[model samples]
Target: MTAASRGILRVVDSDAAEAERNADARSESQSAKDTAQLVELSKSGDREAFDRLVRVTHRDAYALALRLTGNAEDARDVVQDAYLRAYKGIDRFRGDAQFSTWLYRIVANCSNTHLSRRQRQRHDTLSIHTELIDTRPEHDPALQGDRAELRVRLDEAIRKLPERLRSVVVLRDVYDLPHEAIAAELGISVTAAKVRLHRARRRLREQVLPMPGEVPRP
Candidate 1:
């Protein structure tokens, strides 16, 4: 290209980059402001403010509930009940943890309560088809098929795990809770939480790994 053309192109690219940077910065600033505003409003007992928080967190909570309950209807019920309990107990929130973490404790408890009730009624084994409906589909066909298969195996593996180990694994891996938060939520020491997580991971790995010569490594 000619010198003038090159100079114009450079200016255009610079302007585009600057615009993108400005947009990202503005988005970050707005997000921080919104978070702060919500926390302040929630502290003031604004139901709408708390509702906004729920809207943001509900997807994660629902996913965790689904993984634990292994049924869409039950997971939905758990999430709804958890939200209701959280709303009723919002005044007890001390802000020691992120609001999301506190909300997760409620979701976990709700899921546990639902599971215990189901166990008492002797209706705990979920079908693979039923479990599939509770999970989000993967975009790739091969990956989706693999995930579906894994889900079946994982469901069985999770069910077989000891309750304490299962709870830690679900909170840490499925719900993405940090070790400290998991311990705090479960009322266990952090070392105990880590040990449970370790045992759970080892057991899951052994359950999922293929037999010798059955699968190839990259």
Candidate 2:
């Protein structure tokens, strides 16, 4: 193609991309408005509105639950519990934060509880003294594990984090919530959220890629 034609094509592509972005922004704005209205109606005891709100938000909620719980079964259970609790407490929601934010907090809390209960059950079933499994990869100059294996290791490390640290790290890193928002959701100070995230990341690095003489956690 001639230089002028190529330039024209590039301009067209740029305009199309910009228009797509604007459309996405408008769609997100409309979704937020719709969600707010649904929250108000649900708070007023409208069951159908609450069901509509669930349909709108369930996919994202399940994604968050899966990230937090690290398994599909546990994630589904956490989501169910979270929504039930939210329904029971909707009258107390008070609109202090976005409905999605509030729902995410409930999901996180439910995941923590579910995982804790599962851990206790495992402990009861297993021997009194549990053995830690060290999952160090092959001794390559570069840790040559594939991306999927690395992700599994990371998920395992996140799962082993204490509830407080796990919640903060997942909110900040996985969900990309700001420290301020995380603190608001968790009802903690921003400083506490930052501290927990730093500690969680440090622990994760230790577990996922231990230095010489350091023990990797299970």
Candidate 3:
């Protein structure tokens, strides 16, 4: 072979070797290895392994659901439903992403489904948080109490937002997902995600924090 052709072949081989090394490194990471083992076991009908997987991820799932649904009962229901779906779908799971990421997507889908059903049924008219927020004395001196009150108000404000706006806000702001990722997860265009996020923020600010020159409610 000519010297020029030999050099090009060596460079291509070097790139391939580097790529293989990187892939190996990723596959060997402790978390990835453990997740792979758990996934394999779960796929083989090992109920205990699947339970462990759910246990590790349930808190995060519940937190996401709570943000999306704004009601503890609804959030619990969504998480439970998501877990049941996951258990059924585990064998079909592809390892292209972390199990947690896949699970979060399921939770997001379930959250969206629950919100849609609630809106359709008009069953979200009564908010359980109302009494909780109303009875908390605004003058509570404890720092922790003030923070708790603020959280409740913020959550209530989010809960009252329109469903589309609420989903965008919770996924982007509460969950800290980037706009593009949020779009993909929610199955919307990136531009739509940004617009929804902007609207959601505006609504949240108007409701949770008073606008300039507006009197604050007691």
The number of the candidate with the highest TM-score is: 2
lDDT for model 2, please.
0.81
Candidate 2 lDDT, tens digit per residue, 1-218?
A: 99999999999999999999999999999999999999999989999999999999999999899877667998999999999999999999988778888888888778878877897886433221113536445433126588888887787667666667778888888877778877776678999989999998887887777665565553
Ten consecutive residues with minimal summed lDDT in candidate 3? 133-142
How many Å off is the CA of 195 in candidate 2?
3.3
Q: Local distance difference test, per candidate?
A: 0.75, 0.81, 0.78
Better of 1 and 2 by lDDT: 2
Compute the lDDT of residue 170 as modeled in candidate 3.
87
TM-score of 3: 0.65
Q: Any runs in candidate 2 off by more than 4 Å, and if so which?
A: 124-165, 178-193, 202-218
Q: Can you give the lDDT of residue 21 in candidate 1?
A: 100
Span of 10 residues, lowest total lDDT, candidate 2: 124-133
What are the per-model numbers of colliding residue pairs? 0, 0, 0
Over 4 Å off, model 1: 1-32, 126-164, 178-195, 211-218
- Candidates ranked, most accurate by lDDT first: 2, 3, 1
